[model samples]
Target: MLQHPKYIVRRLQPADAPSFYAAVRESVDELTYWMPWCSKDYSLSDAEAWMQSTSDMWAAGAEFPLGIFDATTGEVLGGTGVNHINRAYRIGNIGYWVSSKRTGQGIARFAAHESAVLGFGELGLTRLEIVVLTHNRASQRVAETVGAKLECEARNRLYFQGSPHSAFVYSLVPEDVR
Candidate 1:
């Protein structure tokens, strides 16, 4: 677990499903535009399945999907992960989102930076990427605030909502964080 003064970042557990469900339901409207998995039809069962899948992937060393939570109350604040790993090159992609109610509160930024620390310090990653949709200015800000350098706007870098979209690709190396 990664402890922060404002929050904690840790692997998801089955017991977290209820909070995850509530968070997703609250944020689905905002999340739907950027996250393909979140929708009006999202259910608690989906959250449970997500927790399970994340756990399975972690066990397999395939991915690390984690939760951002309140340090005092354990309420779900957001989610972040180090995914799309290149183990041979020690690189990974960092993705994150905050609950709608917590937008503009720096939770996403905090969770993202801590996730980078996790990637570099424990996951042994030398490089991490923050790929955000070109239109997502909020996410872009989070990447920049976390000290990731804007490498370029790559063409067709992401597929979202059944279409290809260009993305701002940011690079975060060990030095970028420390």
Candidate 2:
């Protein structure tokens, strides 16, 4: 588990299902726009399945999806991860999202930076990428705030919700952090 001054970043547990579902449900409108898997029809069963998938991925060292929680109250805040790993190249993707009500509170920025630290320090990744859909200004800002250099705008970099998207690709190296 990783700790921040006001939050904790850790692996999901079975008990987190209820809170996870609530978080997703509360942010479904915003989340569905970018995260295709989360739709208006998202249910508690979906959260359970997601946790199971994340557990399997963690065991395989394929992807690491962690939940961010309030340090004091243990409330589910959001999620961040070092996923889409290319182990041979020591490269991975760092991504994060926060509750809509918590946006503009620097939570996403912390999650972004911490995830990069996890990528470099724990995952031993030499390079990390933050790919934000071109239209996602808030996420782009978080990537920039964490010192992930804007590399380029890549066409068709992501296929989500059954469509191709142009994305702003950012890169972060170990030196990018203190």
Candidate 3:
């Protein structure tokens, strides 16, 4: 787990389903815009299943999905993680999202940075990537804040609700974080 003055970052647990569900429910509209898995019908069961899947992935060393929480209140802030891990290449992709109310608070930036630290420091990863939808300026800003370089733009790189979207690919190496 990673701790910061304003928030705590950690792996998801089954017990977190309720709060996670609530957070998603509150921001479903905004989240559905970019998150393929998010929808108006998302349920607590889905959150629990997601938590279970994340746990399994962690055990298999395939991916890490972390939850960000309010440091003091323990409220679910959002999530960030290193996914699509490619062990052979020592590379992983970083992704993050915050509740609508938490936007503009720097929470996403902090969580993203911490995820990079975990990826490069603990996971022995050599490179990290952040893919942002072309229209997602907020996410692009987070990648920039963490020193990720704009690598290129790809067409139909991200899929949301079964449709492809163009995205800007940003990359960060260990030295970029340092």
Candidate 4:
């Protein structure tokens, strides 16, 4: 478990599949812009398979997938990850989602901040970017709250719910945190 009192950002486990599926089900519609893979009728089997693949990637040092947990009860609160790690460039992108019931309470901001610290201090990543759907002010706030600077507008960058939408690309460097 991570050191944060409100939440723990830890790697995904096979045992978390059920809770993960439950959270996904609870937030399916609201997460369309927040979650890149949000879609119809996500299942427990899919969560299990994803956990396996993600765990393997973390073990192989190829990527990191973190599940935010309630610090006291160890309940899976949501999911976050650093995918497409580029060692040569010392960079990675952060993607995350929070349970709808858990939103607007600073949980996503807390998790994303801790993840950013881990990426820089432990993983030695020098650059991180968070891409938020143009209209997702809540998520954009999370990105800015974590010290990432608004970089550019990525036109037609995301395809969510069968429609092309633009994204605001926010970026951070090690110095930004300091």
Best of the candidates, lDDT: 1
Q: Write the per-residue lDDT of candidate 1 for residues 20-97, one digit (tens) a residue.
A: 999999999998888988888999999999999999999999999999998999999889999999999999999999
Candidate 1's TM-score: 0.97
Query: Highest TM-score, which number?
Result: 1
Write model 3 residue lDDT over 128-173, tens digit each, in one string.
Answer: 9999989989999999998999989999998856788889999999
Better of 3 and 4 by lDDT: 3
RMSD of each: 0.9, 1.1, 1.2, 1.8
**Lowest lDDT 10-mer window, candidate 3?**
157-166
Clashing pairs in 1: none
For each candidate, how many residue pairs have backbone atoms clashing (under 3 Å)? 0, 0, 0, 0
Candidate 4: clashing pairs of residues: none
Off by over 4 Å in 3: none
lDDT (0 to 1) per candidate: 0.93, 0.89, 0.92, 0.84
**Residue 101, model 2: Cα distance from true site in angstroms:** 0.9
Which has the better TM-score: candidate 1, or candidate 2? 1
Look at candidate 4 and tell me the lDDT of residue 9: 88
Candidates' TM-scores? 0.97, 0.96, 0.95, 0.91
